[model samples]
Target: MNTDFLVIGASITGINVARELKQRFPDTTVVVIDKESGCARHSSGRNSGLLDAGFSWSPDTLKARFCKQGNQQLSDYCERNGIPLNRCGELVIARDGDELSDLDEIQRRAEGNGVKLEPVTARQAREIEPRARVHEQALFFPSSASVDPAAVMRQMEQDARDAGVRFYYETSFLRKAGDEFVTTLGTVQAGYVVNCAGLYADQIAQQFGFAGNYRLLPLKHNYLESSEVPGAFRTHVTAAADLSGSYPGTQIFLGVDGKARLGPAVKPALWREQYHGAEGFHPFEMSSVVTTGIGQMFQGGGEICRACLQRFTGSTHSRLITAGSRLVEGIRASDYRDWARPEIQPQLVNTETHRMVSDFIVEGDGKSMHLLNTVSPVFTCGLPLASHICDQVAAATGR
Candidate 1:
């Protein structure tokens, strides 16, 4: 198949790119390729689904811009397409009495990003959430909301097909065969190629002399839900904790069917695509073995959940030793249950700096662009990010 625009990876970014590309060049042929059977089967499918308020990233970066705009665009898309969305705002609590300054910093960053935020007293925070414990103050992001990430992508695939865009599923990109790409299915030529394959994007772009010193530092997170906290969180609530200590800051969301979900114990991962005991799965293998740190083991999914629980903050790390029965005043230890499925987030580690890349990185000219980092809140910012990429492509292709 010969296509004018070839998009690699059917994650939200690639799907949106295909949609925008087709919209820009109605007469041109656009082809989107993915190795999976359908879209959002990987990172897009396995995520917390919490819409970002753009208060985390620096205001002077692409993340702040796209995330802020994408929040609204995606919400509108969901509303128009009949997809589910929860506009229940967010409450950013302090990790401790000392973390109020961090909340203040986030508020300042939100202001710089043009995101609306207001500080609420602890009394008000309790009024908003009767069960959750909070500090003396919390930042309220009115724009923060939640959406069904997988559902959004499913609708996108259908809409893209209806828009005359070609989709090649169950087809994997192998290598560049002269003017075409050699895939598991067959060889195909494209005028321009875009790499948005979240996990393996580095390998793909490196073949084209892109992604200089970037490597994926896959971070794994497990969802721990309270067995009986249903309808507890009226609005999504998170902590204004520092980035250190592998702090998987807690978040209480009014989840599907009115159940309350919590905790995403974030930890660096050894495997990018496979989780221990996750249905006896492995992406590609040569029977290699690697050991975890002291007092750590990954036998399977259940073991992974157990290991993550060790680092998980559960309900109250801030008040673990500081508070008493109030931490579990209405919540019980047995109420803490983890979801069977876990999510893996893509984090690009800059080998040059030995630090994680905080902002989104795009490489290559408009003709061939690669989305280097598609992490948290990306689904929330998909629409604006796609438009930005489309603009770059238009200028590069002189379309």
Candidate 2:
């Protein structure tokens, strides 16, 4: 097979990149290949599905800039394409005096990133989310929205196909030979290759001698469905404070569907896409999770330990609902047990340190660019990131 460009991975990043490339160079042929039989069978389909409101990262990071733009773009796309979305807003709840300080810092950072955040008192938190039971103040980001992740990927795939992008499913990229990618199906020749292979991105890039800079460490994020409360919660609830130790910032979000799910705890796993005790769990990953979790606890301290304990014990539907209520006042723990389930997030682990990348990393010298570690908010930044990638590719090819 021959094409002008080959996009490895048909997730949001790959499809978005392909679509953007075609839009810019209408005459160029673009081909997308994925190991899965269809689109979004992996991370793109199984995520919190929240369109972040741009407060997650520092203003200087690529994530912060692209996320701010992507959030707006995604909202607009959902509106145009009739994708289901809930602008239910988000609350970064500060539970104690210590968390209040972090909440303030988050607010300041949000302001710097051009995201609007309102510091509301506990009373005000209840006013906005009548079910909220905030112990300290909360930072409300009204612009944050949620979407059905599968729907978004489906729409993107449809759009890309409509734009004349070709997709090859159940085909894996085995390696690269000279200027062609050796795949399970056949060798594909291409002028440029873009690797947006999500969980396997680093491995794919390494096959082409491009991703020696880092190694991917996969972490299993577990989610619990609310057993009792089916439709009690409204807005997303996140930890208002920065937890001590290796816990980045313990936060949980309530989905728009009213089921409260917790987690994405940073449990390191050996496999690239391990989920604990779930359908995708790998037995070999148990030791890794234990070791990494202990290391994180040592570094982060009691806060992460508490959070981990909560997650382990709270895996039950009833416990999750209770935890959600305690964290977010008006939420009825019993009302959410019906809709909770486990969800795993893929983390880009540094090969040397075996630690996850906290920020986004984009690599390419112009002709070909690989989007490495576009973990969480990448979906929200799809538009801006696509534009940026397109601009770079165009400049490199001088097209």
Best by TM-score: 1
The window of 10 residues in a row where model 2 has the poorest summed lDDT is 242-251
lDDT of 1 at 360: 76
Global local distance difference test of model 2? 0.73
Put down candidate 1 lDDT per residue, 1-399, tens digits, no spaces: 788999998988898889889988999999999998988888787676767877777767787888888887877888999988787787777756788887787787778888988888988877766654677888778777777788888998888888888888999999986677899988888899988898778778888789877666566666666676446567776666642123335556655345666565566556677555554344442121132221223322334335345554342433232222232136554556455366777776565554556677788785488888777767777788878888878887888
Against the correct fold, how does model 1 do in TM-score?
A: 0.86
Model 1 whole-model lDDT (C-alpha atoms):
0.71
TM-score of each prediction: 0.86, 0.85
lDDT of 2 by residue, 230-335 (tens): 4555677777554322233434565646555554444445565655445556666555555655565434335445655654554455555555556665445444
How many clashes in each candidate? 3, 30
Model 1 segments beyond 4 Å from truth?
Answer: 243-248, 278-329
What clash pairs does model 1 have?
276-300, 277-300, 277-301
